[model samples]
Target: MGNAIGMVEFTSIARGIETSDYMIKAANVELLKSSTVCPGKYIVLIGGTTGDVKVSMSVGEKYGGEYLVDTLMIPNIHSQLIPAICLTNQVENPGAVGVLEFYSIASAITAGDVAAKAANITLIEIKIGYSIGGKGVVVLTGDVGAVLTAVEAAKKQCELLLQTTVIPKPSPKLYETLL
Candidate 1:
């Protein structure tokens, strides 16, 4: 079997690790909180591969409604993190390394549910929607192809509702530009 990619979003990166892990966790929390607490703004986006992760936030509301809550925050975090959890059969073995980008949690989860059902993939969990255009994450594993396909599908499905430009997870091809 190959690795799998899981996507997630959070209102604020409040999921704290241990004290020693505070450095990285702090940056995530700060980044997530700054974006989500904007009262009303674009969402955050995140995507991750087996050993890699990405993080980003949306510009503003281009999806639906004027303002959105951060309901999917915690659940996205759980869902994205759950795969690695189950894979290792441990709550926090190597932990889940993921990338977050600016995508609709509602869109991602809704599409994810459909994808999971159709593909026989298990859903780790789900949560309500909040903090529109705030924060999102994608976790990838297994075969790079499968993970890439899943990411494309999720974004394509979400584009129907969301109208903002999405920055794809940086790959080697884009590493130079990203740098």
Candidate 2:
């Protein structure tokens, strides 16, 4: 099976933590993030082979029960997606930048993968509702044309999209502030 990533968001931190433990123990997958986000919601992210990710996701969802807020699973996900999610992407001297805002972390992550696959762009960040009122944010950088094209593609695939923008020539300080 191809590589994949999964996420489960919960309204209750206790359930989220329990589910994360089950998810990792259920399959040979890597636990990427397991923590509380803005608005007191918790999220668990994992990655592995497609089949393993699927198995682990099922365990998480089953354990998540009534506390589940949202879920995401991407098979053969874009290489940049994980780094962006972890806020470790290093994009320097960006020619242009694009931003996608969504109401859920899942939507933002899905759109980030879509945008990365659609154009020659580097995903700058995938801020998962941290200090942002439970809204997701995706940022990518590339040439003006690529950034525009990628943003359009991401927007088309995104659900609960709040806003989107492409800055052709962003200020140097703008890039620094994103981190």
Candidate 3:
């Protein structure tokens, strides 16, 4: 058993829904999220052991077919990733905060994982494209140097409109808002 994660994005909701169903049935992976996102796109997230996740993703990709937009598979996903994606992370004493924004949920998730693995930071949140016009947002907290390093590492993975900011000694209200 391992913490592996995978995702598939689709332009057609019908195909996405069908693909998600097939994905779960094809493997022992747990369905994380499967629903329509912003701008009329559909996204499905799944997690399990590395082998199971890989199998599920393969089925999802095959069934996704023409409607597939993008896909991601992380063999060893970070511990904070699921919480961040599900908005269940709790904040602690923070020194600096970093924000990374992307045009796609898959990009944001990929970058978020990179950032988390690159530095000793706490991923505050990884808001997917449920709202905010299909944009993905990642929030993290750590020392100024770590936050900066994490943000920079994450920036390299994005292929679209990306906005990033690092706030040193962020206001408490900012953390509150993020949580």
Candidate 4:
């Protein structure tokens, strides 16, 4: 993982775009993800050294104003987080499975990081926006104990957890569908 990952979610596309541009110009951070999510929201994800990410996020927050819905600056994030967010982490056979849903992308990412660090688990996916009405979802699979621990850790990060579940023994069909 990079030294840090920073994200800013905005309710206004115009403000989000402008703020993202300012962020990139203000620091030496690499733009990871930048696009409009569901419900007309805009999200900007960047990565770099901790100092650079903090500077970029500060610039973004200054420019975001009221349009900013959420901001996240996670230094030394879990190694699996970025890949899961990008939907590139693959699990051939899932064991116990856990899912966490949140109202904000920033919160979801934070929860995922905490969960991953709390237990030995595989992050299956971290889906944001799309058909889920601008919400965020994180999926993980591991031993029953690990899954339970991961879910517990994730729950602590969100004010209102939209949904959280742990399937102790998922059916093969379920794995086929989710993975």
Model 2: worst 10 consecutive residues (lDDT sum): 170-179
Candidate 4: stretches off by over 4 Å: none
Flag regions of model 3 displaced more than 4 Å. none
Global fold similarity of model 4 (TM-score) = 0.95
**Candidate 1 structure quality by residue, lDDT tens digits, 1-179:** 11222223233233211111332232232222222323243334233332322211121112222333332322223243334323322222111122224445545444443334333223322222344333333333223344445445655655333332223343545433222
**Model 4 lDDT, full chain set:** 0.90
Off by over 4 Å in 1: 1-100, 114-133, 160-179
**Could you give candidate 2's per-residue lDDT for residues 79-168 as a string of tens digits?**
899999888888865779899999999999999999999999999999998999999999999999899999999888889999998888
- Number of the top candidate by lDDT? 2
lDDT of 1 at 143: 35
Each model's C-alpha lDDT? 0.32, 0.91, 0.89, 0.90
Error of 4 at 27 (Å): 1.1
TM-score of each: 0.30, 0.96, 0.95, 0.95
Give the winner by TM-score: 1 or 2: 2
Question: Residue 68 in candidate 4 has what lDDT?
Answer: 87
Question: Model 4 clash pairs?
Answer: none
Predicted candidate 3 versus true structure: per-residue lDDT over 17-108, tens digit per residue: 99999999999989999999999999999999999999999999999998999999888888899999998877776779999989888889
